[model samples]
Target chain A: MNIIVCIKQVPNTTQVRINPETNTLIREGVESVINPFDTYAIEEGVRIKDKTGGKVTVVTMGPPQAEDALREAISLGCDEAILVSDRKFAGSDTWATSYTLSQTIRKIKDYDIIICGKQASDGDTAQVGPGISAHLDIPQVTYVRKIEEISAGHAKVERLTEEGYEIIESKLPLVITVVKEINEPRMPSLKGKMRAKNAQVLKWNADDIECNVNDIGLNGSPTRVIKIFTPPPRKGGEILKGDTHEVVAKAADLLKNVIIG
Target chain B: MVDYLLTEEQKMIKELCHKIALEKIKPVAAEYDEKEEFPWPIVKILADSDVCGVYIPEQYGGMGAGIMGMAIATEELSWGCGGIALAFAATGLGTFPILLFGNDEQKKKYLPVIASGKKLAAFALTEAEAGSDAGSIKTTAKKDGDYYILNGTKQWITNGGEADIYSVVAITDKTKGARGATAFIVEKGTKGLEFGKKEKKLGIRASATREVIFTDCRVHKDNILSREGMGFIVAMKTFDSSRPGVAAQAVGIAQRALDEATAYAHQRKQFGQAISSFQGIQFMLADMATQVESARALVYSAARMIDAGSKDIAKVSAMCKLLASDTAMKVTTDAVQIFGGYGYMREYPVEKLMRDAKITQIYEGTNQIQRSVIAMNLIKELAKNK
Candidate 1:
């Protein structure tokens, strides 16, 4: 079996402070780390690989610096790392981004599974995983709480749900987005780190993957970011204080006002 | 809490330490703990990385790292793998005695290999009867011609069975008690030098421990640290400096506990809402988080003091060690409670965390002794108040 994990590099949320000047998410001078949620994705891919002899490869799409995140994945014992980077891909929406990834995956000779975090910390759109699955036309499972089993032809999983959990099974070459409930990612071993220090990452772009240049990157993207701003700050809820009867009367008046509004 | 005030070089050291811990120490932490296996792989990995006689001057082939830098790195590595980090830092503990007191020949001979990570070192002082009261050591080094014949067992020795060289303290004169204690360097394979069975410990079990038995063990007279009657001070001074590292260990442990608890509270539900949403459980987590931050502050303050070259290392280190370890015990216990029955089970990480946190109070001169040191030092400060 061959498993591929999708990871992203996001600004360290713990250290991220807003920049008042541009109101844009600050990337410059802000330390970047692999998205914490994505760590479980890589761990899941590696786990499946460990259970059934297979190769686990981690892939990320971003600027050149995103390679650091891939190196981190490698350090965590991933067998291979790939950087799907292209200048033209910048500013692409999740749809085009996932489409390009699908094009890239079509080029890879063999892979039985693809996995990723439920959402990127910065975007939190949660569209990429399903978007990729739609493009690839493979079964997709989201919010996997646990991996029930992995076989030669199919894999089983327990996906989280609002009610409880749902057991799902999918054919080989399926896509999965996992939550942190899967498992705590293992720390890198000394030997694995030595391997990561010298490991050669496979870098690919539109030309390398043989995708149409026009339909990839910014040119291929269909969405445009006209403006990005924080939502208005929330005000405190109104306080109703008085005797019980008086408070009830006030609450009734407030409800009437809200209904009219 | 306090600033790592990490200089550029110190920052570089932190990065390297982070890499070693995350890449090397993290994975093996559980395996070594589970098997109680000696962590030579991790020690060698560190020896090959940024560790190994880290505090020695650069002229001696060291990184010229400072105590604060070592403290930061040690805590991080311990956070990743406490047992392995302790094993690696044991080299610094053993060789510091030599660096502080050894002659030029000894410095040239020991520091380079140690700095280069070829040799591992251990410090021997604790005996079965003399732990907290280290001054009452009974291990004797009898002088015979040009050699000193050591005859006694050093108990609870770290890296004892595996160390390449040991900085040992023994009574050269039985009449002087604390004043009679003299320090010496005993190399592995020295005649009459031997090891006993490995100890079964609750925590840091992966770090090898054994009784270093010296039955007529012999070494050259030049191996003595500082001078006769100064061994007690040397040991005390070493503890004073090393206490911050132990406190940092506690800080790391507490930080991990809080992180685990916070993450779990958000996921593990009780009744209708997530446990985190409940006021009762939320307050517990809130207090745990606050304690972790406060403990970190105290530990860091002491580290900054030593980094700033404060005249008295005793009072600050004692305060940090005492507060941090006690906080770790409380936070870890609370973390387990928050985890509920899962916390007590082996399947949950909190149980392991609870087990690991218990030792921070026991080792490094138990928190009780740390309080005594704190009071004694504070009284000294009061006596000199102006």
Candidate 2:
């Protein structure tokens, strides 16, 4: 099995602050960390490789500094790392980002499984993983909480749902977006850190992956962010003041009105 | 938080240990303390992360960062919980004799297993009759053919019942006094080796303390550490190397106390103002911070000197242990003072820190013994000058 894990480098959400005047994120002086969710994706990929004896290649799309995230993944037991970076790749939205990653994976060619986090902390859209699956025209199972069994050409997994879960089986060369229930990530060992320090991260540009010029970067993106602002604080709900019988009748009437409306 | 100019590897060790302390150890520290249980789960986590090998040689499946690495690791882990950190630090104390004196075959046989964290090791030097007067230990190892039969009991031994390997000191020749003593390796399951019930303690309650007993327990001659009649030298040398680790634990406890006190003072209100606004509280915080920082400096300096293989380390090592332990005791008490009535309650954290701080001053040789060692070194230096 050749596993591929896609990750993102995002500002640590705990330390992020919004610039009220500009209505934009104040990225200055903020520490960058792997998108919190991506940790589970990397862990699952490593797990799969460890069980079946395969290689885990972690890939990320960002500036050169994103190489640090790849190294971190390596320190966490990812076998190989690739940094997909290019100046032209700037300002890409979920669609373009997923398209670029799919092309990069296509170039790698021998992957049996591709795993991604359900969503990135910076962008809670939860679209990139499915977008990659669509571009590659492969089956995808999102919100996967566990891998029940996996073999040479098939995998059985549990997909988390609002009420419960659904068991889903998919053939080889499929995509999966994992949830936190998948596994608890392990800490990096000293030996792993030493290997990460010296490991050479393969860097690929848009042209290196043979991406279409018109379908890569800001111009290629379909969605746009017109403005960014913090939502206003929620107002308190109205409380009924009366005897228990009267209050119950009034609450029933209000709930009935809401349902009817 | 002053910059000590750490190497990249050292910084990595510090960062990883801090993460483990915060994320894994701190949350369960209180529960373990309450249950008085050995932290085997946390120890397993440390082993999985290869932290058990931080001080061992790389050839023996360790990181080989030496005493400096061990000190850094001990401080960070102790910050999470002093008692929980003992499982690792006590193992370091036991392994020091083997690392310092074990022949090639012994190191090959034991260090790897210890470095792998498959087994914990312990040092046994104290006995019912030998507390500060270590030369008077009653445990005797009589030679019979190719084996030495050990008899008597060792008291208040850390990691006694739990550790898989033990470095025990016993009297081989009564007439030779200190020189009559010898050190030997004793496996936990050896015939006639037994452990007494665990002793209750005022602090570091999570750490196990028990009496290690021997009754005609035979250890092969090959298990002897160095030559015969070198037990006291081995014990003293081992202390010289391990005292910095104890000091690091003290610095960690003091630092945690200072942190808790400072954070509390900023939020605690009295007279319609934060207690931090009062000069009295500010001065106390200042003194605590200063003491913690100085203690940390001394520990790191002493640890670095030992790592650099300095021959004249006994004086500095004793000084660091003395200063750091005393600082931990005083600072923790002041932290409780800052917490006021809340600090006295079991519900609060400062009390536990105070309790934990008391043990550092008494263990790895008491603060009094540490002072004596420093004075003796000074006197010897004076004699050399004369």
Candidate 3:
């Protein structure tokens, strides 16, 4: 069984600061880390590889510096890594990013499963994984909390929901967006670090993956932000100042008005 | 212009170890200290993560990132707990004699397991009779046709009975003085070899320290490191290489104290404002920060010199160990002062940091010993100029 895991490098949210003048992130001194969510996806992929005796290839789409994320995945026991980076891929949104990832996966040509995090921490849109699945035209299970079993051409997994979870079965060549509850990521091993240090990350450009210019980068992205602003701080709720019986009646009236209105 | 840069691999190693220090080691540190137990759970985490193999060679199934890697990783681990960090670093202390002096057969036989981090290793040179004077050790290794019988008691051996492999220094011919000492590899399960009572310590209490008793414990002649009567050279060489790691540990301890003090001062108020607003408090923080950075620089430079294969490493190594450990002692004490009454309580971390800092000065040869080593080298170099 060959598994391919997708990961992204994002600014550590806690350290990131917004530049009020430019309305953009001030990344100068901020540290970059593998997206926290992606770690679980990578861990799950590696675990599957470990159990079934196969290879796990980790792929990512970002700037050249994003190679760090790939190397980090390799340090967690991924067999190989591919970095999709190019100047033309800049400012791509979820649609373009997912299409580019799919194109890279298509170039590899042999994979039984593609795994990804439910969302990137920087932009919690939660659209990229499902977008990639749509591009590949494969069955996908999002918010996967557990993988029950995987064999020749099928896999059983638990998809988390607001209510609870739903067990789903999917055929080979499927996509999965994993939740944090799926698995705990392992620390980088000593030997793995040596290998990652020497390992060559295959760098691919948009043209290298045979992608069209019209469907890549800023030109290809359909969504545009008009403006960005911090939401107004919430005001404290009104407190009922009266006896308990009177306060209860007033609170009930307020709740009834809200529901009825 | 001065610039500090890390190789891509080193950066990854630093980040990884830093995370482990924060997430794994820090939480359990106080518990282990309180219980005075060997942090076997932490040892398992370090070994399983293959952290202990960072200094070992690649041919022996390790990262082979060398002394710099070890120092970087050591500093991070020490930030969590000095005693536990020593337990991990002592493996390198034990493995270094073989790495530096062992022949191909000895290296091949002893290194792979250590590299795999499957078993812990120990260095046993200090005894009741010989701490700084390794030459006066009473442990004797007698050659007896294909085997040597080791007999004596080694005190305060780190990793002690828990370690699987031991690099022991014993006197082969007492008449030759320190030169008569020979290094030998003694497996833990050897007959007549036993561990005496474990010593209770003031700090780094999480790590086990005990007496290794060797009474007619026969070791194979093939297990000899380098050659006969070269144990002193092996011991000295190992210390030269390992001191930077101890220095890094000191730097880490100092950094942790500074971190705690700075964070505490910002929130802790006296009069009508945070203590951080006071010039006195600010000055203490600035000094603590400076010391930590300076200690780190010296430790890193010494480690780099070792990796670069510098021949005159004795002075620099001694300087780093002395400066960093002394800095640790001062910074931790001041951190406690900054905490004032709160720092004195065991519930707070600064007190533990202060306690931990003291051992760095005492072990891996005391700061006094380090000072002498530096002065002796300085005098020798001055005479050479004439």
Candidate 4:
């Protein structure tokens, strides 16, 4: 089995600071980490390769520095890494990003399964995974909580839903967006870290992947951010000090007024 | 934490162990300490991360970073929980004899298994009668045709029943006094080998301590370390290498106490102001910080000296163990003082740290024994110079 995992490099959310004046993220001095959710994707991809006796190839599309994230994925047992980077890819939205990745996968041209996190923490759009499936015209399973079974050319998985879960059976050549419930990620071993340190990540750009010039960068993106701002802080509610019955009636009356208004 | 000018590999070991400490060990430290349960889960985590072989050579399937790497890993894990970290550190203590004295076949046979972290190893020299006076151990290893029958009880043995391999020193020929002793590799499941009930400890309760009993337990003559009548030398050499590890554990425990006290002092209010603002608290914090840093410096230097293949390291190694363990005791006490009433309560972390700090001074040979070793080295060096 040829397994490919898509990952993203995002600012470590805990250290992120927003500039109140510019209404933009303050990126300077912030550490970059592999997206928290994408770790699950990397782990799932590695697990599949472990069971099927194949190689796990981790791919990411970002600036040159994003190689660190790919290297980290390698340290976590990914067999190979590919970096999709280009100046023209700047400001690409979910559609363009997915398109570029799909083109990169096509260039590889030998994948039985593609794995991705349900969403990137920074964007929270949860679109790129499904978008890649759509671009490739392959069956996709999103929010996969468990891979119940996998064989020669088929897989059974549990798809998490609002109610509970659904068992979905899909043939080979499928894209899966995994949830945290899928598996617990392993820490990198010294041997793996040494491998990551010396491993060379294959770098490609817009031209290398043969992406359509019109559908490869900022111009290709369909969505645009008009403005970014922090939401207004919620105000504290008034305390209802009285007997239980009285407080309950007062709370009901206030809630009714707000709902009616 | 001041940068000790560690190499890149050492830094990686520090970072990875720190991550394990924060993400895995810290959360469960309290429960394990309370329940007195061995930290098998944490041990498994350490094994999965390949932390078990930080000091072992690459030929034995280790990272080959040496003693400094081991120190860095120990300090970080102990920062999370000293007791939990002992499961790893004590294994190092047990494996050192093999690393330092075992022949080629023994190293090939044992080090790889230990390096893989599939099994834990323990040192069993301590007995009911042999605390500081290690020369008097009565566990007899009587020679048979091809095997030695071991008969004795080892007390206060860390990782006793749980460890798969034991490096034990016993009297091979009682008539020769200290020279009569011999060190042997004894597997856990050998017939006549049994373990007594676990002892309740004031601290490091997450670690297992029990009596290792051998009743007519037979060990192959090939298992003898560096031939017979060299048990004392083997035991001493193992201590020389492993003492730094114990010191690192002390430094880790001390550093944790300082961190907890500092964080608490900033938020704790007194006289309508943060307690940390007062000169009294400031002085205490300053002293604690200074002591912890100094202890860490001594430990790193001693560990580096050993790794650098310095021949005369017994004195410095003993000094590091003595100073760091003493520092841990003082700093932890001060940390509890900073926490005041809350420090005395079990609900707070400092009290447990205080409890944990006590054993570092007591174990791996008492502070008194360390001072004696240092003094003996000092006198011998002076005599040689004269």
lDDT of 1 by residue, B282-339 (tens): 8998898888788777777787787678878888898888888898889989989989
| Top candidate by TM-score | 2
TM-scores for candidates 1 onward, in order: 0.63, 0.97, 0.87, 0.96
**Model 3, residue B98: displacement in angstroms?**
1.0
Q: Give the candidates in order of DockQ, highest first.
A: 2, 4, 3, 1
lDDT of 3 by residue, B47-154 (tens): 767887888887887778899999999999999999888878998999999999988888888888887767888999999988887778999999999999999999
The collision pairs in model 4 are none
Total backbone collisions for each predicted model: 5, 0, 0, 0
TM-score of chain A of 1: 0.90
For model 1, which pairs clash? A88-A217, A89-A217, A188-B23, A190-B24, B1-B297
Q: Determine which window of 10 residues in candidate 4 chain B has minimal summed lDDT.
A: B1-10
Clashes of 4: 0
Interface RMSD of 1: 6.7
Higher-scoring candidate on TM-score, 3 or 4: 4
Which CAPRI category fits model 4?
medium
Residue-level lDDT of model 2, residues B282-343, one tens digit each, is 99999999999999999999999999999999999999999999999999999999999999
List clashing residue pairs in candidate 3.
none
lDDT of 4 by residue, A1-261 (tens): 899999999999999988878778899999999999999999988888889889999999999999999999998999999999999999899999999999999999999899999999899999999999999999999999999998778999999999999999999899999999999998887778888999999999999999898897889999989976777889998999979999999999999999997
